[model samples]
Target: MKEDMYSIKMRAVRKEKHISGAERIISEKEIEVLVQQLTARALGHSKGKPDFINITIQNIGNQAIEYIAPLNIATITVDDYFKGRECAIKALQKSGLSCKTSQAILNMLKTCNTMRGAILLDIHSLERLEPDENRGVRVTNIDWSFKIKEDLEKALEKKGLNNNHVKEAVALASKVSNAPGIVAELCWSDDPDYTAGYVASKDVGYMRITKLKPLGDSTGGRVFCFDSSKTSIEECIEYLQKKVTLIHKIPMIKD
Candidate 1:
């Protein structure tokens, strides 16, 4: 018998704030098990118990399948999830960014008190790449079925690392960094439970920053720093807006 595929998206909320989220594509037969697993994982998050859990299961065509209830569940601690603020500053300095640029990036992060898409910033000027009154660049409707994702997964697997979030972030960062004039990328999740974020560049691959935000804080976003001298703003923004971006391979940084 042929099997049907489904998309499962889960979000955990506490006091009306988004605390955590997980997404997966699986066969119909595996839906129940996957949902149960994600639900348990969200409840056990170290950020604290969620007041509500929202889950939506859908088919490949975007048709909804089911919506789950507001269930609360347990917590797990991440290794080095809270490396003092100084560590982040030092990490940016070591990445070859100027103190001014580093401080600007931190300031941008502070403004991400709510969920907004990734923001593109000019490294030299410290201005938003595409200015807007309320929102940043929205990275949506990505074609995740691309071969690049599979290749990255295999490469990451070879390294004995299999975190889906890391794989996705690396894939996106690699694409952004490879664009002409683009210098580096920094990202942390808005999900309060997930404290780890990364800084990536073409010269040095993905460097995981153990703690970019405090636990229970949902403010987080991505910043792609670019040099205006190398690439036109229009050109750089066009490249980032493309849905199918391909990179040969990501060079992973080691301790």
Candidate 2:
């Protein structure tokens, strides 16, 4: 019998586009540290051969990215080490991570890093969450609006939404309205560009409440909520349930 380990390296490319109200914003590194720590716990160890991976950043392209794209995007370019049947891969799948964790990790890479930064590291690079920075948003509590819900259902009916999906979308709105990480903030800029719905934020590299205005605009009004910390399909589904347990602890956000 022989023991073997694979050492791999990956290059990640980041493209920044300074759009009207869509300029890229990176939140506190502590949030990122927390998120990465969670993901590392979920995927870093399992049953796998000694595996080493080094990830690097590349900003050779000046392409502008769509504000709403990262929310629904999930792509990963792994080296030959992850042969799909690797022990770690199987353990991750058994943990029900499948590709969801990878996607979240990749998505975090896309949003959390500096327009020009480096996250290239091996297992020693497990994510970390630092102390509080008093940067989380503060918002007032208001029940979700139903009229806006009706409007959304009618507007996207052709997309083939059913009662359940309608419930999810509407629930998503309600969750954001009450979630802890989200806040009802107004763009201080004279002519601010805001994204209407839920999308991943460069802040802490998680899907946070960026803009939240119900019954406003489908693209940029309110309605933003997602669980970017989740790594498995089950966790994604469980996010809605977790929202009910949300508690603002940053000590900065007001009630």
Candidate 3:
């Protein structure tokens, strides 16, 4: 229904689900394959390994890191700490992430016109003084920020769709009966600070998306995260079908 949710530049990052029986501790010569998140089938991330496998980490503290990879952390010895940081940096550069600042990323948005995906500035990214510290901003990435608080407001003013459009979408999501807490956003993708995700199950046993963002082809956004599982599969499918149909029909002001 609704053409199987029209593809957008945002594709949800999917993780099948994985729980380490024990913390994966690292040794001198060995390193851990750090992902945005680990799933039962963490290999799913292999598709975009360059981006997700952040800095090829090490479990310095013998604890499981989830969702977001720790870019830098402090240790007992300054020498050891700085060495680890240096290693991660070298690996980051080697991994092919060249756009090292929000400004560079902004330039990508302004010049490219056709974006693979957008990057949002995170705290880790904000530490850079001018260029060097400004890493982590990358294209073709579903920025976990999904930050559109201001952009969405402007769009609403621009008649991207009236208040009724968002109200209707939120209403539809909430009325699902099976899950009343369901929330929805009228996501706009073209903005550099934007990202949107798909509906997927979390390891917490709830069918909710966590640290997942999807990227696709359209600057125009779409209704992501359908097929709820808190209810019966048949009902979930039908609900998604109906939700997509209604939202797709809603008019979006084309830029």
lDDT of 3 by residue, 1-255 (tens): 111111122122324211111112223332223123222233343233222221233223322212221111111111332343233223223323332532232222223222222222221333211122122112111111123334544654664333322332232322232222112211223322323211111111111111122243223222222223233334433343222221111222332
Which candidate has the top score in lDDT? 1
Return the top candidate by TM-score.
Answer: 1
Q: For model 3, what is the C-alpha lDDT against the true structure?
A: 0.25
Per-candidate TM-scores read 0.62, 0.20, 0.19
Residue-wise C-alpha lDDT for candidate 2, range 1-255, written one tens digit per residue: 322211111312212311111111112322344344333432332222123322322221222211111111111222332231132223323323335543333333223311211221111122321122121121111112222435544543534332332223233333332333322111111112322222222232212222222222222222122233423323333332322221211111111
* Over 4 Å off, model 2: 1-144, 173-255
Candidate 2 — what's its lDDT?
A: 0.25
TM-score quality measure for candidate 3: 0.19
Which runs in model 1 stand beyond 4 Å of their true positions? 1-85, 140-161, 247-255
Flag regions of model 3 displaced more than 4 Å: 1-165, 176-186, 189-217, 220-229, 242-255
lDDT of each: 0.63, 0.25, 0.25
TM-score-wise, the better of 2 and 3 is 2
lDDT of 1 by residue, 167-248 (tens): 5565566566656777877778876776777766654456666677777777787877878878797777766653333334
Candidate 1 versus truth, CA RMSD in Å, comes to 8.9
